[model samples]
Target: MGLVNKTRITDNLAVIIGNQHIDVIATEDFPFDVQIRFIKTDDAQLDDGSGKKVFTPEYQMAFAAAYKGKSAFFSNTEDIKSFTKQLKEIKELFEFATLNKQTWFDTASFDGVLSQKVGSL
Candidate 1:
């Protein structure tokens, strides 16, 4: 199964598997290939004292970027299209964040950089 209640955080970012499952945030079309960050939001253990793992749906996000070096010539069109779609979804998430007047940076380390780039969004 796929992720449920998917939410976009930016044009190049999204929040899937949050609130109920693992907090998964993704970014695409960056300087590097598609990058995704996963966060754990829920309690690590259940209240019943059982050792069973919690359900966290896994999903894939896509993005497009130019291949460097000798790999450029071996690129596949289908893969590129899929990646572009994923990148577009991430961008939509970013737009959503801007509209909601939210900060993209969750940590103090990136606050300065995010502030400078906020104007571009």
Candidate 2:
């Protein structure tokens, strides 16, 4: 048992850009593809004691972990689990992206990100 046995990714995570909040949803499995868009901004904020709604750190991580048009591929359980660990961390951090009103992605890019799938699991 490794990251594989310890992680499950059946949900989406949140990300923050400026004051805007976005969701990180998996559109594909192989060579992972992640896009950005508004999902829960209305309901995705903490009171912060001053009635100021704010995003969480998990959102930051997810945003940092993904960008628009990003692709992900896992060839082995270890790789999948390794990526899963990041997602799990974000989940723990919404509780824990596109580019438009309907579909948008972050222009920002990362060398290693777990967004969508490339080929097979």
Candidate 3:
């Protein structure tokens, strides 16, 4: 998996991590990309918490591992399990993005990724 440059949906921020296409659905008044914010959050928290309305640590680890130059390709059974769990965590986090009537991705970009057949197994 690589960061494949793709189309932008809403002129919003978009970043390609591994095989996943993440787009910014909303921004805080601060003017920084939330995907970057999330990557940074993993560094800051250093621990995954089990609770309502927050990303679990294992989720953070998946992205962190990937960001640290791990290939997006999962070759082992455990790797696949970890990847699936990471996606589940991301889907849950998107609910938070939705509360603001915003999304982590724009429709077109999402469609493009969806169209490309890149998906969680």
Candidate lDDT scores, in order, read 0.39, 0.36, 0.34
* TM-score between candidate 1 and the true structure: 0.32
Best by TM-score: 1
In the range 6-113, model 2's lDDT, one tens digit per residue, is 123344433333224333444244223443333222234467798765653221222233423356677999988967765664434333222222212232222122
Stretches of candidate 2 above 4 Å error?
Answer: 1-69, 96-121
Candidate 3: 10-residue stretch with minimal lDDT: 112-121
Candidate 3, superposed: residue stretches over 4 Å from native: 1-70, 100-121
Measured with C-alpha atoms, the lDDT of residue 95 in candidate 3 is 41
- Residues 1-121, candidate 1, lDDT per residue (tens digit)? 3544455555555555433232335454342232332222323333445765444322222223333334433268887776567557656654554453222233211211122223320
Report how far residue 70 has shifted in candidate 2, in Å.
Answer: 2.1
Each model's RMSD to truth, in Å?
Answer: 12.9, 15.7, 19.1
Candidate 2 vs candidate 3, lDDT winner: 2
